[model samples]
Target: MSSQSLEQRLLRAWYGKAAWLWLLRPLSALYCRVAARRRHAYLSGERDQWQPPVPLIVVGNITVGGTGKTPMVLWLIEFLRAQGYRVGVISRGYGAKPPHFPWMVSATDDPAVCGDEPSLLVRRCGVPLVIDPDRPAAARHLLASADVDLIISDDGLQHYALGRTVELVMLDHERGLGNARCLPEGPLREPAERLESVDLVVRNGAPGDSSNGFSMQLLPQTLINLATGERIAAVRWPGPRQVTAMAGIGNPQRFFRTLESLAFTFDTRIFPDHAHYDASILESLPGDRPVLMTEKDAVKCAGLAQVNWWYLSVEAHLSETFEAALLNLLSVPHSEKIEQE
Candidate 1:
């Protein structure tokens, strides 16, 4: 089976109770034991941790699948910039294979080499970002090169070797912990109790367990035509359009649902998270149909401009109360923030 199909199957097993849930329990027990031990090793000082010179914010999810971490990171970056804080971003580039350990990403960099998300961030925010498996090392590189006052580790909550100043855990409200088992048995990377320790819990979509934290949502802004560079409102576009909605990210169905919410009628094409696209994939889709996609997919499809392609752009907006609370948690002086900028 193709990797995409395999993951879909795995997600099914991980998401809900099934026969396989019982089958995987033994392995899950072992996995959870190892996970707990590994975390304790770092927490107890058996393993050395690296701390960034500046305050570090971690944008991560405890669940296996995505919980809108990218949008939250983008929103955080924009919010920090508006607050006059110089921010840098670091991430473990999954699909990237750079010759060196720490690779600096630029707007013109190829997504195939630097990973799709990093390329998208460069194109979207134009901030200084580094991709390395050792996230703390990446942050160090960014600090050495730029005058950034703080760093954001895109998604490294489980990576205990990297010490963090603030931790914000993002969760998909629709899938809240998914059977609450770790690894092969279910979707969680760590126990569900891990949520209690994070500084803030960011829930995407409808009402969830919001007793302690707040909710955030992605507002679709506009769709950009990759071919002509034209912009159209996602909801206000006038057309009984036959388009192909494509997404090659974690939770492909989320993109489809968002498009449906915007009243777009289109066939769905879901690819594995971070799947590399080639000419063959484009050929498989119907001809002459406008293709709608997430901005992350657009970065990979930048060269495959053979079809009429457009990608949705979304702005993540947080509650005003949450905004004030987050700023207070960071506790940086307003005058210092302005001076850093």
Candidate 2:
């Protein structure tokens, strides 16, 4: 089966009580067992853990699909930077194969080589950013190269090799652990119980447990014309005009919902997570109507975009209590911040 079709089937099994979901339960159990064993290996020191000289914070999710990790990561980075701590970031660069183990990603780095999310994060982040399959190696490289006081690992909660000081797991409000099962049976990398171990659980919307950790709101910012780099208000595109929305992120439904909220109507074409788009494929879409995509997808579609292509940019707004709660939760003193060169 094609990757996109298979992903759809798995998503259905995860959210719905389908008969096929039951058949996948055994494999899910095996997946959990292996995951538990690996985690135990790291916790028990059976596997060597690389600790950074500075504090390393990880922003990730227990759920399998997109739970707004990217937005949260940017929020945390901004929060940390405002507090005067020199920060850096690292990502696994999924779907990208670089020439080396530790690849330093720059603002101008090719999205096709560094992966869409990593490239987007690097562009938004002024801090040192590195991408590698081995996250520990990337972290080590960042620490050695930059005089950063803290490090943030994007989307690697299951990667226990890089010793983390704090774990901030992001959860979607509506789909919080769909069916509450792991992997093939449901949409979780770790089980629901894993939330108990995380330092903080951030809800991306109002429909989640506020008492568990804290709530975060993703505020939709203006849309950027991918073809010409012009900013436009999201609401401006919604008269009787309809556009085609394209997203290749982990959760395309979230993008569609955002558009709906803005009073925009569009036909959706959701590709698999981190899927690339070529100019020819984009050319097939209606040229008369604008094409909207996520910032992640915009990175991959940079040179491939036509005049009507645009991408929505979002900013994560943390709850008032979350900022103070995070500071208290980590027990880090702002006085200890070292200004990096």
Candidate 3:
């Protein structure tokens, strides 16, 4: 009926039916050509690079949204911290209201100001998270004050100007670069073949054995109270019930399926990636029902303190071999890393 409704319907249908959209590749290639020219000019010294003090590892996807980058970033942060590396995070602060310039995220900062994802990261992870359009600038600010050693961008695979050391590309096992095309043509930010060029490829969930890249499994559904930090055993919510589950995430159906698998029946409401939720939308849902959402949305729904909500936290389990390989890459001398790149 409307543009928003059309987008929602597409998302609901596209994940399982990628081949139908693959026909758009010719147009996607054309868009890539124009984008590549701009990228080449910038890389060839015709444009200035925004460099950060510390090495940056970009966790991103070719598709527009929901390849599980946030969980992957969370995994990396925890893994690096376990390895004794001081780390800070930076995000572009997508979908903030009254969009402000680079600012450090605090519990007090409105999600309307710093964005939902950045605010969630700051609150849940307890790491210094800065919101800025220029990721390099935000990374610099965090590095200068926090004494951090490395920077992990939430998503910046295409933001090549902010120089990075290693790039980890994430793919949704179910969606696998829908139509394998670029914006307006399909869903890819770059061609599917670009996966071969990245340092590492991560497929979230069981991508099925194809004798290909490494795989990371997402932990089963679990609930964490947004306010109390208390965990409710997932089994506590028995199904065939009318709970209200809201997801304003990159892919809402993935979350809906997750809730279903956990036996929590829902009247599902799917919002666009980074959708800003106001009072009215939250108020429209069944008020008496238990409300649930992805961790990303919980950050934005902070003001809905009156509503009972739990964040379904997903944990990433990267293989030991992948970890070892990544460590080896990181261990290489900077000179060697540059040479390898």
Candidate 4:
């Protein structure tokens, strides 16, 4: 089966609780055991971890798919900057193929080389960013090259080699834990119990149980034309109500739901997460009606986008309580945090 098909099937099996998934339970059990041991090794100091001199906060998720992490990281960047902190970001740059490891990414950097999400983050905020598979190497490089007092490791919660002062885990409130199983049997990379260990947990939507975690809403801000640098409020989209919606994200349905929330009627087109796009692929998109996509996909389609193509820009909005709690935690001395850990 094609990778897209396989991913769809797995997503369905995972969230739908398909009985066939039971067949993968043994493998999932083994995967969980190995992952637990690896984490234990890091905690026990069997593995060397690079501890940065400055504070480092990790914004990541336990699940394998998107949980609005990019938006959360972006929100943190702006929030921290507003609080007078110079922040730098590090990412694994999944699917990126830069000429060298530990490459510094700029807003002008090609999304195809440094990956879409990193490219989008740097472009959106112009924050200093470094991309490398080795989280420690990326963190060191970011510190050495940028005059940043704080570092945000984008999606590096599981990278135990990079010591962090804070961990913020994001979860899709609707999906929760998807059977609460690890890997092949479900969507989680780590076990569901891992949530208990994170410094804070933020649900991407209103939590079913208000006391469980802080709630976050991805509020649509505006829509930017890809062909030209024109911007319009998303609520005032001037195109036909029935447009083509294309999303190459871990949760395309989430994007579609956002469109629905905006009162738009759209035909859907889904791609594998981080899938690259070209003129040929887009040329086959069925209609000349406005093509709407997520900002993550827009980064890759800028040069190839048609005049009618636009991307919805959304911002993460967390409650004031969450913000005060986060700042309070950061106010705690790093030494105290380490000692507590």
Output the number of the lDDT-best candidate.
Answer: 4
Q: Which residue pairs show collisions in model 3? A: none
RMSD of each: 4.1, 4.2, 2.9, 1.8
Q: List the residue pairs that clash in candidate 4.
A: none
Prediction 4 global C-alpha lDDT = 0.89
Whole-model lDDT values for every prediction: 0.84, 0.81, 0.76, 0.89
Model 2 residue pairs with clashes:
none
Report the candidate with higher TM-score, 1 versus 2.
Answer: 1
Candidates ranked by TM-score = 4, 1, 2, 3
Which ten-residue region of model 4 has the weakest summed lDDT? 1-10
Q: Which is the winner by lDDT between candidate 1 and candidate 4?
A: 4
TM-score of 1: 0.93
- Order the numbered candidates by lDDT, best leading: 4, 1, 2, 3
Residues 1-341, candidate 1, lDDT per residue (tens digit)? 12366777677667765665878889989988998899989978999988766788999988877689999999999999999899999999888987786999988888988998888887899989999998878988888888899889999999999987788999888877878888888888888888887888988884533685578788899988887888988877765577888888888888888888888788788888898899987678666677888999889988887537889999887888888878886897534643543
Task: Return the TM-score for candidate 2, rounded to 2 decimals.
Answer: 0.92
Q: Which candidate is the best by TM-score?
A: 4
Name model 1 segments beyond 4 Å from true: 1-3, 332-341
Candidate 2 on 256-340: residue-level lDDT in tens? 8888899788887878887878876666678788888899888888888887888899998876677887777556532332221
Q: TM-score of model 4 relative to the true fold?
A: 0.97
* Model 2 residue 315 lDDT score: 92
Worst ten in a row by lDDT for model 1: 332-341
